[model samples]
Target chain A: MEALYHVAPFTGYIYPNESVVPWTVLIVIYPYLTGLVAGAFTMSSLYQVFGMQRFKPVAHFAMLTSLCCMLIVPLPLLLHLGHAERALNPMITPHTTSAFAVFGYAAGFYVVLLLLENWFVFRPHIVQQAQQRKGLLGLFYRVLTLGSYDLSEKAMSYDRKWIFALAVVGIPGAHGLHGYVGFVFGSLKSREWWSSDLMPPIFLFSAIISGVSLLIVLYALSCKLRKVPIDLDCVKGMAYTLWGFMMFALMLEAVEFASLMYRGREGIEMILEYVKGPLVIPFWTVQLGICSLLPVLLLSFMIWQGTKGKTLIVGVVTCAMLVLVGVLMMRWNVVIGGQEISKTGKGLLTYHMPWVEQESGLTAAILLMAPFVLLAVAVRLFPPWEDGKAAH
Target chain B: MENKVEKLEEDGRRKFLRLFGAAIGGGGMAIAANSLLPEAAATETPAKAAIPAIPGYDWSQHHWAFGVDATKCIGCLRCVEACKVENNVAKDPNHFRTWVERYVTLEGEEKARIDSQQDPVNIAAAGAEGKYRFANRYKDAKVEKAFFVPKLCNHCTHPACVQVCPTGATYKTDDGVVVIDHTYCIGCQYCVQACPYGARFFNEEKRVTDKCTWCYHRITKGLNPACVEVCPVSARVFGDRNDKQSPISIFLRNNRVTVLKPESGNAPNVFYVGIDKEVG
Candidate 1:
């Protein structure tokens, strides 16, 4: 492990320290997961703030998923730090010029908003749980209620008003949440790959695509598990939303790439080579071709022709899954591809993720899956469904 | 009367021995532990700062910069070795506070084939005279222009590394040297990514970001850094640029020099004579 830091297999002139890429798969996962939270929160607003009736059934569930994902966004960052214990230092004493200094505050504010909004929206259920359940579970529900057992009509209206207000605030908070991730990379003037004005919008839209996709897929799966009919209207609505955002994200990315080529930035050729070489298959095949183009085509066709029954369900599910993969690929390209170019314009470098379980490929894979575990725990606790059916 | 007196004397001796033992055990242990504390705390003691404080030394008055005469560099790797030894830099090929790169560009090519050997230089070839060949593997290839450029922290006036440090762990001193506060560095490597010169590295042993400080300790003591001291050809020079009589100031005035990657707009303080466009 120690040897890897110093003995970088570089092809050309790179600073000795620049030889080994510092940010790893863990950093990649950081933005990827946070983007999901941002996207999910925005998708929930489709019903809450926008009053899209079809999105109503899964709005609360979207909030739950977003919150769950948001909770785990900092896990990768914490793990990546050499001194994980001092993670609070940035929050405690933020350097004003540093873009990353805003992370702790942004994340804290967003999480608090999500918690408050979620609690108010689910207060009725909490009161019921507090009264109906027995022993530790009932005690836990009572504690979660925070001493408010009001089940009156007036109180419910007030909760609704607060929920509405919080949802309005959450729209920009969602953008701020993940847009800041883009700023962390974009603000870096050193790396040509990440230093761009369009990074925030690109990150934000892609985040929406991933979040909406995850919710659509999960909502469909939950309905299936409960032996209930699929919410075709809801699924189609999300698919359309996903399609619009994914198209915007893809377009912005294309513009960024085109400008890089036209302007002939310092490391443009190195990045082009990166896309052509080791990244060829993944960049073109999985990320752009299969995941992006395929889903865009499928979703567009579904929205235009209005397919019925199984075909529509299959298309929406498949497109959602592809978008999820596409977003992850985008993150991989941004975080890892940015490091491929050497600071010395003369050459390029490569990085291979290690298989070691602690801080390597397997560990990143496990960390990516960690949100789902939390989601499961949250489902057991709060029940994101209105039917009171368990989320399988 | 004799027995009582003898008993009283014995009791006094026992009391004295107990006090002596306690003092030796407790006080001696405390003194030893204090000495063994990490250098961070030890450097804070008044004794450590008493290194003949240079007369009239104030950070505000001094603006430091580095100079390199690329034409005179023999690529002996002495500077690289000296820097690592002096700063306790991790002996990693990829982790260097200072290093020498030998650039060889063929005719009619805009790009140069550059190679850097940061490992200890091998000078002990038996039967060989004083003339020593460098670790340049491309010696046999078609040579057009080849010269060695030693690189170190530029101590930029507007250091990107210091700008991106989340906790201000890295900062530019009033004296114009960019340095990392290892005690406060979170080892996030944002500064590493932000540094255009690739001067920053994560020291695995220390678990903190490390960079060339232009030998902050030695500079304050009115001494040359280990690298400058060990350079056989006096190719590397570092001093206050404000000092009109300093070698760096004289060299800057006399030589046609360029800062690496002037396009970066980092305003690097390290000026190089005979630096090629191909060199970073």
Candidate 2:
């Protein structure tokens, strides 16, 4: 008989003494970056897709979020590896044979859309803002446009198409970028927890949920802070979108559980235990209850005939909760939940977050907070909704 | 124990000298496992020059191999310590070239508690009053059987690390060995994800990626891999897969050896004579 002693152990969980293997660090960075992408693009789509003239106020906020989020997409995957420096080898000499790689186009392609969309949509307004402000702010606006001060009808038309076309292309690119992340997990055959076919859909749906929810929350905050009137009807419309996407997101999560539970596949039962245990609170409190169900209830109530301002208020609050809970629970389900199963479907692996693991909770929190700081700077420069007086 | 050491030393010196003698043997035997031209062609024409030949290292001439008896693994830190000293792996929280993982499973079922125990001590530090089983400090957990797998780069014949290096910074040696040309690495981190075994790691200090190199520096001088040399139970084996007469060859012929994650298709050169199915 063949004995087990010929090879050392192989499992994903990092032992306490061995601090180098960072599962949590990689997981947090993944969702945080994806959240921003979802947040920015969904914000843009509200103005373009649903055609809410009022939500058009923060269209630029969508653009800025997309750019900032895309900037840090590579950092998480880089830090996840044993050899971060050798990361370039695959990009430079791509192995067509290995399917896991080949995401080289994700960065340059998305950046082009961002730069174009920014130029097309915001240039004229930035120039006008600069003209009004005589100090360094005006010079900054002029430089932002590279000195093309054209305000002709032709320019306005061109800007709309640029916004429309990029928005169209970016949706698929956004799907591809985030879907590729699902591909990263889906490709790994070592862990059955990540091997589900539903990973791509779940990730994509969650991205939309996180994305749209962020827009609702951030836009409401921006308007309230500025003492400006919010487009209540526009928010009600977004609530519909949020509710629709949330239904699918919740359905997908159920499907993921049902499939794994139905067959009781190798470690699926144990994984369910972790999800229903270590991840139970996050899953129920943040993901299922607050992130998913609460938003649905709010939107459903509005659909059954509620006032615009009330629906808007409920919609914004629901979105904020979804944003906080959706991304957090998704991360825990992946990183912590995956480690709780045995390779042989025999027993369980236990993991608890200690105070100072390299990529501990605090580290993740700091990285997550950085985008808000960046977003604040961007909002000040190009407020999504300009005062109506400028329209005249 | 003293008698065993004395008896083993009788033919040791000259045999040890010849181990490297064969290391410099060079030429006539290399396995270009990732030729990618089609396996049938390789089977038909076995005489093709798989390797163009390099000084002191030749895959065609590779004859040394590695072996391990899992039952004997006491989870000592000797091999890990030796690899660190030999390679100068950084002591940062993010760097690791070679390390030991303890896989603690439930008694009857293969329920696994897998984690890295960075520094492993002898049986004493395992902290048990009466049991023969080893205890992992993370949970002070005990199990029926604890398997310790010392993981490093497998040095595959078709290494994804070299295959993905955009700058040609990583390449397989003339001896059918894979190596990273560190100076050329741009640190984009693509190879880090491409590895099926999760073998390649990013080195922030050097701003490059690193993994096990089959102990190229020592292997060139006819010495065994640090892990192999330091293992008390001879659990890690290294040799030329092409040499049908080598001990690694005999073991492969006699045992049901396996590679980690054959589905990955990298065709790793490092083969375990008796690896479990759950690992890959």
lDDT of 1 at B238: 81
- Highest TM-score, which number? 1
CA deviation > 4 Å runs, candidate 2: A1-20, A49-60, A71-105, A130-135, A263-265, A269-273, A305-307, A339-363, A386-392, B1-54, B59-85, B88-153, B156-211, B230-236, B259-268, B272-280
**Candidate 2: residue B248 lDDT (0-100):** 72
Candidate 1: count the clashes.
0
Cα lDDT tens digits, model 2, B1-280, are: 9656644663474365345323322110111112223322212211133443446665556644455545456677577667766787654323456656666676666656565533233234534311112334545544565677766666666565555444455666656556666766665444554555556666646766777776888887777888788888777766666778766777678777677667656676666644444554
TM-score of chain A of each: 0.97, 0.84
Q: Which residues of candidate 1, in runs, are more than 4 Å off?
A: A1-8, B1-57, B107-110, B118-133
- Per-residue lDDT tens digits of candidate 1, residues A8-44? 4667566767777899889999999999898889888
TM-score for each model: 0.88, 0.73
| Cα lDDT tens digits for candidate 2, A1-392 | 32111112323453222222325455657755775686568768767765767566666677777776676666666654445666665555543333333544455556666766776677777878767877788788877765455577975785677578678767776776676667556544446676678887887777877776777787677767777777676576666767787788779879987887887865566566665666667667776777667767766776777656655586566665665567667867675565455433434555555334444556566666667777777666755555542210
State the local distance difference test value for candidate 1. 0.79
Worst 10 residues of 2 chain A by lDDT: A1-10
Instruction: Please report, in order, the local distance difference test score of every candidate based on alpha carbons.
Output: 0.79, 0.60
